[model samples]
Target: MSPYLLIQLAALGLYLFLVAVNWSALPEPMAVHFDASGDPNGFMSQAWGAVGIPLMVWAMFFGLTVLGRDPGFFARMKRFSPSGWRAWAEFNTLMGLGLLTVSSMTVLYNVEAIPGEWIGYSVWIFLAFAFLAIYRLASVGR
Candidate 1:
């Protein structure tokens, strides 16, 4: 499997593991959102908080991975040449991996497995790395 696929799988697996381990410990109505200062500012039922975001991440990853296998689809949408279409597909998959990482970390934070402050800082750092990855992948074969 591709490194991107492996990373996505590992992230999703880790998220599921974390959620399972913390399931019983988490409050009934969990904090799903945080303010700039890292305080919980928004909330949702524990079921949604634990499972909903991960499901969405999984769906997005699956969709992007499938799309990556069909360059013609992206080409038709964006007028990319074959190689450009391939690059776009890879970049989309990379973005999905990044989202999985961020979402997993956020879930961990919400479950109190990690420090609240780490969420914001880690997200910014992840964004920087994600941009770099996208730039490198998109520039391939150019």
Candidate 2:
């Protein structure tokens, strides 16, 4: 298995574990969205709050895994050539992991599992690292 896949799987597992451990403690309607100040600005039922974002994250992971395995898929998309598909997949996986980390932290914050001004800072850091990773991947096989 690819190391990227392993990391993504680990992140998914950790996210599921966190949700399982904190599910019951989450309020009926949990804060699913936050404003610039890190204050809750939107809400959703506990079911959605706990599962929705993770589901989306999992979908991205699955899709990217499929795309990575089949570089030919990129040939149909004018934006990318088959030669660059693997690197694109690598970049996607990196971003996906970053997103998973941010989502997990957001969930934890909403459930009050961990506290502080984390969401904002974490996002900035993730974006910076993601861009750097993508740049490095773009230079691969050149």
* TM-score of decoy 1: 0.75
TM per model? 0.75, 0.81
Clash pairs (backbone) in predicted model 1: none
lDDT per model vs. reference: 0.70, 0.74
Task: For candidate 2, give the lDDT.
Answer: 0.74
Clashing pairs in 2: none
> What shift in Å separates residue 76 of candidate 2 from its native position after superposition?
5.1
Error of 2 at 46 (Å): 2.0
lDDT, candidate 1, at 105: 65
lDDT of 1 by residue, 2-101 (tens): 5656666776787778778878888878877777777778888877777887568676766676666665656554545656645655665667666666
